[model samples]
Target: MVVSARITNFLAYSSLTVSRVSHLGNGSLRYQWLLCRNTSLLQLRSKIQTVVPSITSNVSVPKENIPTADALVRPDLEGLYEDIREGLTNTQPELRQIAQYYFNGEGKAIRPVITMCMARAINYHLDQNAPGVIQKQKKIAQIAEMIHTASLVHDDVIDVADSRRSRPSVNILWGQKKSIIAGDFILAMASGMLARLQNQQVIILLSQVLADLVQGEFMQLGARENKDERFAHYSEKTFKKTASLIAYSCQAVSVLSGADSTLQSIAFQYGRQLGMAFQLVDDLLDFIATSAQVGKPVAADLRLGLATAPVLFAAQKFSELNPLIMRRFQEPGDAETAFRLVLRSDGLQRTKELARQYCNDAVTQVAQLTPSPYQQALVTLAHQLLHRMK
Candidate 1:
């Protein structure tokens, strides 16, 4: 979804990094795969070359992964996600089954993990003795993840997608109507968890994220005609769809941390900037990554009649793209021509530059937090997001 890159002076030279985005929903993985004993970096290098042949690799992946919440948050943190289905335990048998499908195996857990990390970081900033696990904030993390998974479930139906995480899509396994119900069930469960938190501010913050998801989907249904305006439209839609949850979730955790409004605003900014960067990288990858790599169709955006950052950038060099985007590629051969133009143009590179800028901005905003292992981990996360591959 939404996330960035930049190293701070306090961070070790060897920092956490994510080299791939292996899957989207259940079993979503990032970077740590290279550290798996069975998987080698050399193998990873060859795989990256094979999967994202369009983009030339530049940033070097570390042979050894630095310690971060990706590894640390497991086992003990498992409870945060493991039994979320229990929230719907009282539902009808089939309803519970569809709702709990993805919850069976956690995805990357990016939103919730970052939420937990932010809570401690902000607590340390306020001079509190932060606990290893704060119940309410952890609940917020769970809610964030629940909201994310729910959106993806609905997204599959909207995209008419057949697979997720290399597995049959919820809509594929169970018809679209059932998939829609399952997605709603997930959101309903998330809402229940949110209300139980009893923090009005938290409720309000996450509630906005819910609204943004719908608004983003609406935005996705069309594209702007003006070249410059299209980029703005795309970026704004990206913020609402992918970044909103991450940004607000971070802000929600900051609120729970009892941070002052100023600190809370900064925390929200950190998440927002990173979320923007994360989606930009994803847009670039659509042109670069294969269907086998990212677990979704390559150029899925184009197939959906959407114009992302890369296509917008390409339009500057090849004015012909403007008409295709406006028509939603309705004309025959439009999609193919646009694809070739994007590859030959510097669109991906330019888009990557913009993504990195946002990543850098994310780093700058989080730097305000008092230095803590949690804060450092957050910083390392932003840095690693730039190079995310899966």
Candidate 2:
């Protein structure tokens, strides 16, 4: 157990800068960017030293200062995660290998963690003696994560993305065809897991989520040539592509736990709002977060001809910017210009406001739950989704 110090520093620096940004004066944006850039460089240097220790004898770090993976993961979900990880690794070795490549290397596993938290919240409130409840919850969480990972794999292929989680993408490592096959394999495996639940409602919800994911991809692909119309299409796509899974995840848990229809609807709404907020924030991070922090090139969405929320908002103010954004991002300088335009536009602020509104709605949805630590954690999770830097 010891975790990497680089991750600890990234979290520390990112948190500090995000907090300081709120108090910054109007003219201090450049200064803030410099601060972020310098911190990111330091973080990168630290990572290089860790990955290739002998190559950099000049770099020395304190062992005790490093944080553990356990610190990032919620302790309440540890047992559940153990089961999920075991199942994933044992059942589908190839998918597990790819998943391990991504999971062990980066990502906070925040989504499944949230799913487990919601499940535990329900379990705490009702069904004190529900047999096999923990097993079912863990399986659901794992299946959800598998579907998510599969989507990312396919997304990288579709976007022609070279990097993910600060490393070369699976498509880059193994080739696009293999990457696509791997994604499809994971999707099939995930479906099998869902079928085991023998719950028709869960199966239907997840099947619809898969369909929405595909529809979103197609929508983005079709809208590539039309810049002026990209915003509406992109917004609708984000709702289907990103928000639907999250919404259904909440609904799935509620149904599995035998909660009333009203509670299930509330949970679904909470997740939908939170997922929209999450994607909006993700779009903002593409412009604001550093390459090292975000684990992808800045403005990657724009480069891929996929208009994200911030870019859509920015396009509203500068109609002339649409042509520039529609151009395939294959050119060397296109991404930089897109980045600067987004930064200078009011879209960033507007997108943040929209995300905050959704976060507020998420909090309201969960407010009806009786006061408990898990309920408070859900509210905090919603806020975290809105405010997280990466």
Which candidate wins on lDDT?
A: 1
Q: Write the per-residue lDDT of candidate 2 for residues 1-390, one digit (tens) a residue.
A: 122343234233222211110000000011223334434433433433233212112222223333322342355446544544554575456666664455442456666676766676666666433657666766777777777778888877776666676567887788878788778877887898899999999899989889988887776667664554454455567777778877888788878888888878877877787787787777766656655665555444654555566666667666756776666544655545555566567666666665666666777777766655666677777755654655
Q: Write the per-residue lDDT of candidate 1 for residues 46-101, one digit (tens) a residue.
A: 44334443332453332245568566455435776566877767788987888888
Candidate 1 lDDT at 340 equals 72
Which portions of model 1 show Cα errors greater than 4 Å? 1-66, 130-133
Judged by whole-model lDDT over C-alpha atoms, candidate 1 comes out at: 0.70
Evaluate model 1: give its TM-score: 0.83
Best candidate (score: TM-score): 1
Tell me each candidate's RMSD, in Å, in order.
8.6, 11.9
The weakest ten consecutive residues by lDDT in model 2 span 19-28
Question: What lDDT score goes with residue 213 in model 1?
Answer: 87
- In order, how many clashes per candidate? 10, 0
